[model samples]
Target: MYWIKLSKIYFHGFVAAMGVIAVQGCVLSTDLPDYKATLPKMADSWSSQLEYEVERSSIVSVSQTWFTPDFHQRISGFIVEGIKNNPELKSARARLEQQIAQYEVSESAFFPKIDLSGDGSRTKSSSKGPDGERIKSYENSFKAEARISWEIDVWGRLESESQASYSSLLQRQRDVEFAQLSVATRIVLQWIELIALEKQLDIARQEKSNLTEIVERTQDRYQQGVGSILDLRLVETDLANADSTLTSKVNEHSQAVRKLELILGRYPSGKIQSAKEFPKIVTDFSAGIPSDLLVNRPDLLIAEQKVIAAHHNLNAAKANRLPRLSLTQSTSYQNRKLSDLFDPYSLVTSIAGNIIQPLYDGGQRRAVVAQNKAIEDETIAEYVNTALKAFDEVENYLGNEIHLKKQEEELSRAALMAEQGQNLSRQKYYSGLIPILDLLQAQQRFFVSKSRLINIQKQRLLSRVNLYLALGGHNTPLQKIMQTDPEFSEDNRNL
Candidate 1:
C-alpha cells in the first residue's frame, strides 16, 4: 500500500513538472498592422462610373465567358500548349515544390531527434605494483548508446517559421498562376496580330491589283495619243508604290507568324497557319470593384502573401529574443568483456534539461529584430502599391475600351464614304469627265481609309485583350474567386 502511494505521488510530480514547462513556453504576441483598412475605395461599377457607355451592340459581356466561339480551335490549342510547355511556368512550379520542402523542414523542429551510436576498442598495458612486481594486462571494451534530444518551443519560434514557409509556398503558387495568365494572354494577342497581318496582306494585294489596272489603262491612252506621258508616269509610280506596300505587308506577315511560332515553343519556320480573319472578341468588361481585385489578380495575391510571411517572420525574430529550453535523454551499455556487453548490470540511463538565455551577442539579436520589422514594413508598402496599380490598370482599360469602340465606328463610316467616292471617280474618269490625277486621289483615299479601318479593328481587339488581363484574366467573377479555396476566402476577408 505504501509503494502504491509512493508511485501515485511520483506520477503527480511528473504531471506537475510538465505543466510548469508548458506554462514557461513562450507566448508570442504580434502587433500585426491592419493594412487592409487602408486600401483605397474604387468606383462602384465600371459602366456607371466611366465617362462613356461600355455597353454597345457589338460589346458582349465577358463576365461569364473567357474565350468566345470565334477564337477557333487552332488558337485555343496553341494557348494550351504554351501553358503546358513554357519553360518559365515549369521553373515556377519547381520553385513552389522547393518551398513545400522547406515548409516540411521547418515542421520537423516540433519533434525529437534520436540517434544510436556504438564503439569497440582493444588495449594492452603494463603496470608496476608494490615497487617490486610487474603485471601485464589486456582489455577489450564495447559501448553502445541511444540518445534523444528536443527543444521545447516555449516562444512559438518554430511555429512562426513554419507559418512563414507556408505563406511563401502560397506566394509561389500565385506566381505560377500569374505566369500562366501572362503566357495565355500573350498567345491570344499574338494570334490576333497574326490574323490582322493576314488581312492586311489581302488588302495590299487588292490595292496592287487596282493599281495594275490603272497602269494598263494609262499605257493604252498614252499609246492612242489621248493621255499625256506625265499621266502615264504618275500611274506607273502609283503602281510601284502599291507593289512596295504589298511586299512589306508580306514580310510583316511572315515575321508575325515566326514570332508566334517561337512563343509556342516551336521552331520559327514562318509556316504557322492562322485564321484568315480577325476573330470577334467580347468587348464589354464588368470590373466589380477595387476590393474584388484583392481576390482576383495573382500578383496582388502574391503581394498579400508576402505581407503575411513578413508578419510571421517578424514574430519569429521577436520570439528569438527569449530563452530556449532543451531536454535530452540517453541510455547506454559498456562492458570490458564482449559477451557481457548486453548484461543488465552494465546498463546506464540519464536524463537532463537545459535552459539557455542570451546574455550578450554584440546586439545581433536586436539587429535581427529591427531588420525583420523593416522588411515587414516594406512588404506592407508594396502590397498597397500593388493594389493601387491593379485599380489603375482597370480604370485605364475601361476608358480605352469605350474610346476604341467609338473610333472603330467613325473609321468604318469613313471607309464606306471613301469607297463610294472612289467608285464615282473611276466612272467619271472612264467617261472623260475627270482627270487621271482626280481618279488617283480618290483611289488613294479609299485605300488609306480601308487600311486605317482594319488597323483600328485590330486595336479594338487588342483593347479587349488588355481589358481581360487588367480584370485579372479569364475567371474574375466573385463566385469563381471564392471557390478557389477557403484560405483564399479568409485572406480576402482579411483584406
Candidate 2:
C-alpha cells in the first residue's frame, strides 16, 4: 500500500508539472496554424462572390407569402417552418430527442442507486402443540424500509458509458440537422422546377399565339390562290398541334407545382407566384489540407465520435469480465404494529461489500467481449467510409456545378436561334416562298430548344442545392429558430 501511494504521488507530481508547462505554453500562443486566415483562397473568393449574388438576388419574404394562398395558409419562415412542417424532418428530430433522453437516463448511472420499499401481508400457520392440538392464528404484518446501494465506478466504466451516451446525443443532434438540410434542399429544388415549368408553359403559349397568326395568313393566301393547298393543310395541322402542346405543357406545369406544394406541406395551387428569376450561387470551392477537414464536417465528426464511443463500449465490456465492487447497507425499525415500527430498540443495521467472479457461463461472457470487439471494428470501418464519402461528395458537387453552368449558357443560345428560325420561316411562308411544312418544322425546333433550356436551368439550380448540402451549408435555419423561439425568452427560465 505504501509503495502504491508513493507511485501514485510521483505520477501526480509528473502530471501536474506537465500541466503547468502546457498552461504556460498555451499562454504563449504557440504559433498554431491560422486556420481562418489560411482558409483556401478559392473558398474565400467563392464566398465573396456568393455573398454578392445573395445580396443582389431578389428576396421574397416567405414569411408573408402564403404557401397555400388559396387556403390562406402561410409558413412562418424557411428555417423553422421548414423543419416543423416537414414530416420526415420531424421524424428525424424525434430521434434526436430520443437520444437526448437516453443521455439523461444514462447520466443517472453516475449517481448513487437507492430504493425505498414497503409491503404488507397476512399469514396463517398450523403447528402441533404440547397437547397434540393444531391451532390457527391470524395477524397483519407491515414493513417499510429505505434501501441504499451504490457501485463506486472506481475504474470509470460508468463514466465512460455516460461519455459515450453524450457523444451519441451530439451525433443524433447533428443527424437531425443534416436531415433538415436535406429536406430544405429538396423543397428548394422542387420549387425551382415548378417555377421553371411555369416559365415553360408561358413560352408554349407565346409560340401557340404566333403559330395561330401564321396559320390565318397562310389560309388567306391559299384562298387567293397565292398559297398551295398542301401549304394550307400543313398550317391547319400545326394549328391543331399548337393547341395540344399548350394543354400538355400546362398539365406538366401543374404536376410539378403540386409536388413542390406537397413538400411545403400544402396542396398544389395553380396561382402560387413563382419568382421571375432563379437564385444565383457561386460554385467555386476548394477544401484545404486533409487534416483541416475532420472538424469542419459534421457527419465525419459524428462518425469519428461513434467509433470512439464504440471503443469505449468495448473497454466497458472487458471491464465487466472483472469482478465489480459494490457496497450495500440498510437500517430500519419494524414491528407487526405501525406504532412499534419507529422504535429505536427494534432498529437493525447491516453493511457489506460484494464480489462476484464468473466461475462458468457457457462462454457467454467471452462471446460478449468478442462481439463488442467486432462492433468496435465495424465502427472504425464506418468512420473511415463516412469520411471518404463526405470528401468525395464535396469534390463531385464542385466539379459538376462548374460544368453545368457552361452547359446552361450554350442551351440558352440554341433556344434563341430556334426562336429566330420560327420567325423567319413564318414570314417566308406568308410571302408564298416556302410551304407551311417548313413553318411547322421551325416551330418544333423552337419548342425543343426552349424545353431544353428550361430543363438545364432547373438542373443548374438543383446542382447548387446539392453542392450546398455537400459542403455543409451554414446552419442558418437553427440560428433563425433561436431568435424567435419562445423558449429563449428570459421569462422561460428553468425555474
Candidate 3:
C-alpha cells in the first residue's frame, strides 16, 4: 500500500516533467513552410483574343451548363446516359471513396490506441524437502490487463499527416469532376461526327442516283447509234465510283455510332441512333480570365492539390526528425482463481511517459527529409507545366473558332456555285452541247464542294464543344454536389 502511494507521487512528477519537455520541443520546432511560394505567377488576362472583355466570377458561375433544353434533345439524353454509366468516371469516383477512407485512417492517428489481453496458466512441481522427503505442489494463475498508449504531437507531425491525406482526398475529388467533364465532351463529339457522316451519306446517295439516270440515258443513245461507246463507258465509270463513295460513308457512320456506344458503357452494336440533325452550337459564351482556371478547371485544381499534398508530406518528414513524446497507462488484475481475477483488492495501475530524440539513425531521417523536399519541388514544376498546357489549349481553341467561321462561309458559297454548274452541265450534255468529260468533271466538283461544306460545319460545331471544354464548362451542378459535404463546403467557401 505504501508502494502504491509512492508510485502515484512519482507518476505525477513524471507527467509534470514531460509537460515541460513538450513545451520546450514546441518552442524549438518551426512552423510549416509557405507552400504558396512554390507556385508560378498567374496571368491577369488570357493571351487568346476574346470577343468580350474577361469576366471575373465565382467558380460556380464558371460552370455554365453547356447543354440547354433547346439544344439537341437526343444529345442531352445520350450525355445523361454516358455520365451515369461511363466506366472511367465510375473508377474515378471509386478512387475518391478510397481516398476518403485513407483520410479517416490518417486522422485516427490523433487518438490513443487501446488494447485488452488476458492469460491463464496452471503449474505443478515436485521437489525434495531438506530431509529428502518428496513434496508436490500445484498453483494456478489468471491475469487480465488493459493498456493505452498515445503519442503527443509536439512537432505537429500527426497534423501534417492528416493534412497530407486531406489534400490527397481533395485531389481525387477533382479527378472525378474532370473525368465527368471529359466523358461528356467525348460523347458530344462522337455524336456530332456521326451526324456529319449521315449528311455526307445523303450527298453520296443523291450523286449516285443522278449518275444512274445519266448511265441509262447514255446506254439508250448508244443503242440507237447516237452516242459513242466511249461516252457510255465514261458514264458507267462515274456510276461505279459513286456507289463506292456511298458504301464508304455508310461504314464511317456505323463506326462512329459504335464508338459512341462504347462511351456509354454499352456493347458496340452500332445500334445507337444519333440526332436527326447536327446540334447547333452557341458561340457567344464568355471566356473568363486565365486566372480563373486555377479555380474553375478541375485538372488545374487537381495539380494544385498535388502540390499541397507534397508540401504536407515534406513537413511531416521534417517533423519526424524532431523529438516525439509518448504516454502509456495500464491496469491489471491477477488471482489464483479465474473467478477472482477482477477483484478490486487485486488490481494494479501504472502510468508512464517517455521522450525519444532520435540521437542517431545513420542519416536515415535526414535522407527522408531530403527526399520529401525533392518531391515537393517536382510537384511544383508539374503544376506549372500543367497550367501552361491549359493555357495553350484555351488559346488554340479560341483562335481556331475565328478561322473556322471564315472557312464555313466560303465553303457555303463554293457549294452553291458548284451545284449550279453541275445542273447546267447535265442539261448541256443531254442536249449534245457538251462532252461527257465536261459533265463528269462538273459532277465531281459539285460532290467535293458539298462534302467540304458539311465537314466544315461539323468542324465548327466540334470547335465550339472544344472551346467550352477548354473554358471549363460543366454539364452538372458541381457546386451543389460538393456542398453536400461539410468539409467540401468549407473548401468552396475558400475557393
- Cand. 2 TM to true fold: 0.76
TM-score of each candidate structure, all chains considered together: 0.84, 0.76, 0.85
CA lDDT, every model vs. true structure: 0.80, 0.65, 0.80
lDDT of 2 by residue, 336-399 (tens): 8877877887677888887554568898877887897788677767766776676667666656
lDDT of 2: 0.65
Tens digit of lDDT per residue, candidate 1, span 224-310? Answer: 998889998998998898889999998998999998877777878998887887776544545566667778788889998898899
CA RMSD (A), model 3: 5.8
Predict model 1's lDDT versus the native.
Answer: 0.80
Q: Where in model 1 is the C-alpha error above 4 Å?
A: 1-31, 47-49, 52-61, 65-68, 72-74, 124-138, 282-285, 337-339, 474-495
Error of 3 at 90 (Å): 1.1
Model 2, position 481: C-alpha lDDT score: 38
Task: Score residue 183 of candidate 3 by CA lDDT.
Answer: 81
